[model samples]
Target: MSNKEQLYQERLNRYMTAMDCGKPDKVPVCFGIGEWAIKYTDYTFQEVFYDSEKANRIVEDMLPDFDVDIFSGGPTLWWPPMFDVMGSKLYKFPGIGLEEDNTFQYNEEEYMKAEDYDDFIANPTEWLVKNFLPRISAEFAEPGSYRATIALIKSSAAFAMFGAAAGAAAQRWAVEYGMVGQFTGFTKAPFDTLGDALRAMKGILTDLRRRPDKVLAACEAIVPHNIYGGIAGPGADTRFPCFAPLHRGAYPFLNPEQWDKFYWPTLKAVIEGLWAKGKRMFFFAEGNWTPYLEKIAELPEKSIVFDIDTTDAKKAREILGGKFCLQGGIPTTLLTYGTPEKVKEHVKRTIDELAGDGGFILAPGGVLMGDAKKENILAAIEAAREYGVY
Candidate 1:
C-alpha cells in the first residue's frame, strides 16, 4: 500500500478503537478548518459559501499543515447556491443579504404554525413538501407558478451536485491527505426538526405551554424520518457515526420535566432505531447537558460518541466513559480568546483528567468561532500529541 493509504488506515484504527472504548497508540485528535481559515486567505465569506471548488481547494491547502487524526469538517457548512436557487429564507448568506465578509445569519420565523400541527403530524413528508416548503422558500410561495417550478428544479439539481462534490472531496481527503472524517450522515433530534426551522424557538416555547400534546405528536411524527436520514448517506456506511447536532434539549432550554416529556423520547427513539441498523450517533451535544448525563447513559452501550460542550467532563467520564466514547475537551472559547500556552496547559490537563483510561478523542468542545486564533489551535494539537500517549 501507498504511504497515504497506510496513514489513513492507522488514523481510522485509532478512531475505531477509541469509539469502541479502547486505547489505540495515541488519543485521536479531531480538527477542522472553520471559517477562521478565511482570514488567513484572501477569499471573502461570500466567495467560499458560493463556490464549492474554491472551498475544497482552501481545505486541501490547509490539510498538509494539520497533523491530526480525524477531520471534523471543512470551511463552508452549506453551499449557499442551493439556498439561493430555492430562495430559501432559512439563512441570509454573506453577499446576498449582508456584507461580503459577514457570516450568514439565520432568519428564524414560525414557518410551521401551531394550527398546521395536525396536518404535519398526519403525514410529515407530505406536510413538508406541500406546506413547509412554500412557507420557507420565497420562490415557492405560489405553488404552481412557473417561478416555483423552476426553483424546485434548480434547487434539486443543486442538492445533487453538492452531494456529489462533497463525496468527491471526502474521497480526495482520504486518499491524498490521509484524513478521516469523524462521521458520515447527518440528522437532528426530532424536536430540533420541529423547533429549529419549523416552529422557531419562540413558537416552540409557547407551544410547550398552550399546545403540549401537539408538540409531542409532531416530534413522534418526526422520529422515523430522522432514523432514515441518519443512515441514508453514501453506501449507508456504518464504520463511523452519524452527526446529530442536538439543540433545545440542552439544559434550561426546557426544564428537566419538559425535556423528559418532549425532547428525550423521540431523540432516543431515533438513536435506538439507528443503532438497530448498526449505526451510531455523534451526539454533538452543543450546550450544557449537565442535568441529563445520567439519562443519556441509558442508551445501548457504544451507541454514541457523546460530545462535550458545556457538559461537565468529569461527570461524563464517570457516567459514559466505558460504555461510549467521549469526544471534545478543548473549549472553543480557549481557541478564540486564550494564548497558546494556556491552550497547551488545558490540553495536558484535559488528557490527564478525561482520557487517562481510554475512549476519548481530543477536540474542541464546540464549533470554533471565525475569530479563533490559529496559534492557539496549533498549540492544542501539538499538546494533544505530546500529552495524549497512553
Candidate 2:
C-alpha cells in the first residue's frame, strides 16, 4: 500500500475498532469543528460566509495543527446568498438580509398547518415539495413568476456548486492528511423532523398531548427517510460509521410515559433498520438523558456508539458500560475558561475512566463552538497522546 493509504488506514482502524465497543490501540479523538473553524481564521461571519473557497482553505489549514484522529467540517457554512434570494422564513444568514456580523439563526415559524398532518404522513417527499417549500420561501411559492424562477435557479446552482466543492475538499483533505474519518451521514429521529420542519417546536410539544396519535404516526412516517440516511453514505460503503444526532427527546423534554409513546419506538426502529442492513452508528444523544439510562441500555449491543451531551458521561459509562461504545463530552465552557493543564486533566480523567476498557472515543459534547480556547483543544489531543494507551 502507498504510505498515504497506510496512514489513513491506521487512523481509520482506531475509530472503527473503538466505535464497536472494542479497544483500539488508543482512543480516537474527533475534532468538533463547527463555528470554531470560522472563528479560528479571525474572519467575520460575513467574510467567511461570502467566500466559500477562502473559508474552506482556512479550515483545511487548521486541521493539521490539531492532528485530530477524525476530521470534521462536513458541509461547511455556505449560507446567506440563497436565503437572500429565496427569502427564507427559516434562516437569517449574515449580511444577506441579516444585519452584518450576526451569525446565522433559524426562524422556526409554523410552516405546516395542524390539519395537514395526515397528508404529510401519507407522502412526505411530495408534501415537502408541494407544500412545505412553497410556504417557507417566496421563490417556491411563486415558481411560475419569471423573477422568482430565475432567482431560484441561480441561487440553487450556487448553493449546490459550493456544497459539492466543500464536501469534496473535506473528503480529499481527510485522505491526504491521513485523518480519514470519512464517515459522515445524518438521521434525525422522525419526531425531530416533524418538530423542526413541520409542527415547529412548541407546536409539536403541544400536539404531543392534543393529537398524540397523529404525532406518533408522523414520526413513524419519517422513519423510511431516516433509514435511507442510515444505510447510505461514505460510512456505509467504507470503514467509517454512520451516526444519528438525536435531538429533542431527553429528560425534561418528555416525561417517560410520553417518551415511550412518542420517541423511543420510532427511533429504535430507525436504528434497527440500519443494523439489519449491516450498518453501524453512533447516536449523538443531544441532551441529558440520564433519566432514560435503562431505556437506552435496552438497545441491541455493540451496534452503536452513544456520545452523550449534558449528562455525567462517567456515569453513562457505568450504565452503558458494555452496551454501546461510550464517547467523550468535553464541555466547551470548561475548555474556554479553564487553564490548559486543567483541560488536560479533565480529559485525562475522562479517558482513564471511560476508555479503560475500550469502546470509547473522545469528542466535544456538542459542536466545538466559536469561542472554545485553542490551547484547551490542544490539551484534548495531548491527553489522548499521554494517557489513552491500551
Candidate 3:
C-alpha cells in the first residue's frame, strides 16, 4: 500500500480497536477543525460557511501537520447558501443576517404546536412537509405561491449540490489526509427531535405537564425515522457509528422520573434498534449526565461511544468502561481560555486517568468555539500522542 493508505489503515485500526473496548498501540485521538480554525486564516465565518471549497481547502492544509486518528469534522457545519435559497428562519447565518465576523445564531421558535400532535403522530413525514416546513421557511409559507414553489425547487437543488460537494470533500480527506470520519450518519434522540426544532424548549416543557400523552405519542412515532436516519438510510455502512447529539435527555432538563418516562425509553429504543443492525451511536451527550450513567450502562455492549462534555468522566469510565468506548478529555473551555502548557498538562492528566486498559479516545469534550486558541489545540494533540500510548 502507498504511505497515505498505510497511515489510513493504521489510524482506522486504532480507532476501531478502541471502539470495541480493546487496546491498540496507542489511544486514538479525534480532532476537528472547528470555527477556531477560521480565525487563524484571513477568512471570516461568512467566507468559510458560504464557500465549501474554501472550507475544504483550509481543513486540507491543516490535516498533514496533525498526528491524530479520527477527524470529527471541518470549520463549519452547514453551507449557508442552502438555507439562503429557502429563506430559512432556523438560523441567522453570518454576513447574511449578522455581521461578517459574527457566528451564526439559531432562531428557535415553536414550529410545532401541542394541538398539532395528532396529525404529527398520524403521519410524521407529511406533518413536517405540510406544517413544519412552512413554519420555518419564510419563502415557503404560502406553499402554492410562485415564490414558495421556486423556493422549494431552489432549496432542493441546493441540497443536492451541497451533498455532492460534501461527499467529495469527505473522500478527499480520507484518501489524501488519511482521516477517518467520526461518524457516518446523523440522528438525534427522539425527544430531541421533538424538543429541539419542533415544540421548542418552553413549549415542550409546558406540554410535559398538560399534554403528556401527546408528547409520548409523538416521540414514539419518531422512532422508526430516527433509526433509519441513524443508519443513514437503507444499505448504508455500519462500520462507523451514527452521530446523535442528545439534548433534552441530559440531566436537569428532565428530572429522573421525567427522563425515565419520557426520554430514556425512546432513546434506548433507537440505540437498541440501531445496534441490532450492527450500527453504533456516537452518544454526544453535551451536558452533565452523572445521574444517568447507571441507566446508560443498560444498553447492549459496544452500542455507543459515550462522550464526556460536562459528564463525569471517571464515573463514566467506572460504569460504562469495558462495555463502551469513552471519548473526550480536554474541555473546550481549556482550549479557549488556557495556555499551551496548561492544555498539555490537562491532556496528559486526562490520558493518564481515562486511557487505562483501553477504550478511550482523546478529544475536546464539546464543540470548540471560534475563541479556542490554535496553540492549545496543537498542544492537546501533541500531548495525546505522548501520553496515550498503551
Candidate 4:
C-alpha cells in the first residue's frame, strides 16, 4: 500500500476497534471533510465534481497534511440522485460553492398536481423501475461504475436541495406521493426508503400530536435498516427537529410545548425504534438537544452517539456518561475565528476532559464549512494527534 493508504488503514482500524469498545493503539482522530478543505486547497468545487483524478488528489493531499484517521469520500456535501430522477432543475453560483441551496428547483406546477397521494405513489415507483433503475443499473455495469454512480447520486441530491430552486421535485414527490408508504417501508428498507418522506414542520408536529401512531409506524419502518448497523440514530444537520432552527421561518410558529409535543416524540420514536432493532446510534444533536436530554438519555446506554453542537459539552458528558458515545464538542466557528494557539488549547482540554473513559470521537461539532481558516484547522488536527493519543 502507498504510505497514505497505509496510514489511513492503520488509523481506521484503530477507530473501528475503539468504536467497538476495545483498546487500540490510541484514540484515533477523524474529521468530516467539507468545503473548508476544497477552498483551502487550490481546487474549485466544479473541478472536483467533474474530474475524479483531481478529487482523489485533493483527498490524498489532505490525508498526510491533516493526519485524519478516516478519509471521507469527496463531493462530501452534494445532493442525492432522487432529485434528478424527479426532474428538478438546478442553479449554481460560480464563486460561492455547490450545496443543497445552489443545486435544485422543484417544478411547483408538477408538485401541485402531484398532491394526489395514490397517483404520487404510483408514478415514482413506475418511473424508478422503468426509467431510473435500468439506466442506473446499466451505468453501474460500466468499469468503475459504482463509484461513478454514487458520485452522480450525491451530486444530484446536493444540488437539488441547495440550488436556487425551492427544493428538489423529488423531495416534494416523496412527500406528496410516497411519504406514507415509504415511511411504512422504513422497516424493510430503513436507509433507502424510511427518511425519504418530507413532512413540513407543521405537518410533522401535527402528526406527533394527532397521528402519533402513524409517525411511530414510520419510525418503525425505518428501524429495521438501522439493525444492519453503521452509525445509528440521525445527524442533526437534516430537516429534523434539531436542525429546524437553521432554516428561516421553520419553527417561529411553534411554542416549546408544541415542539416537544410534536418534534420530540417523533425524535424519541426514531431513537427507540432503532435501539429495538439491536443497533446503537450516534445522534449528532446539532443545536441543543438539551431541551430533550433527559428524554434522549432514556435510550439504551452506549447505543447512541450524542454529538452536541450548542449545548454544554461538560454537562452532556456528565449526564450521558456510559450511555452514549460522545462524538463532538469542538465548534466549527472557533476553528474559523480562533487563533492557532487557542484552537490547540481547546482541543487539548476537550480530549483531556472527555477522553478519560473510552467513548469519545474527536471531530468538529459539525462538518467544516468551506470558509474555515486553514491554519486554525491544521492546529486542531495537530492538537488531536499530539494530545488525543490515549
Q: Each candidate: RMSD to true structure?
A: 0.8, 2.1, 1.0, 11.4
Clash counts per candidate, in order, are: 0, 0, 0, 28
TM-score of each: 0.99, 0.93, 0.98, 0.63
User: What digit string (tens of lDDT, one per residue) describes model 4 on residues 186-208?
Assistant: 12222113222334344554445
User: How far is 177's C-alpha from truth in model 3 (Å)?
Assistant: 1.4
lDDT at residue 194 of model 2 (Cα atoms): 86
Instruction: Score each candidate by Cα lDDT.
Output: 0.93, 0.76, 0.91, 0.50
The digit string of per-residue lDDT tens for model 3 on 1-390 reads 988899999999998999999999998999899899998899988999999888998898899997889999898889897788788999998999999998899998999988899999999999999999998998999899999999999999998888888788888888998888888888888999999999999999999999999999999999999999987642267889999999998889999999999999999999999999999999999989999999999999999999999998899999999999999988989999999999999999998899999999999988888999999999899988888888
The segments of candidate 3 whose C-alpha lies over 4 angstroms from its true place after superposition are 233-235
Ranking by lDDT: 1, 3, 2, 4
Give the Cα RMSD of candidate 2.
2.1
Tens digits of per-residue lDDT for model 1, 66-99: 9899998888889998899889999999999999
Candidates 3 and 4 compared by TM-score, better number = 3
The count of residue-pair clashes in candidate 4 stands at 28
Descending-TM-score candidate ranking: 1, 3, 2, 4
Model 2, range 1-390, lDDT digits (tens) per residue?
877678778788887787777788878888745665566566777887777766767766766676677775632445567666776678877776576566777788889988999999899999987788778887667767886687679778877876687668766776667766535566778888888878888899889879999998898889989989876545466345576767778778888898888988998888888777776667777778888878878878866678777877767988998778777567767877888899888888878777877888887776665677877888888887788788
Q: For candidate 2, what is the lDDT?
A: 0.76
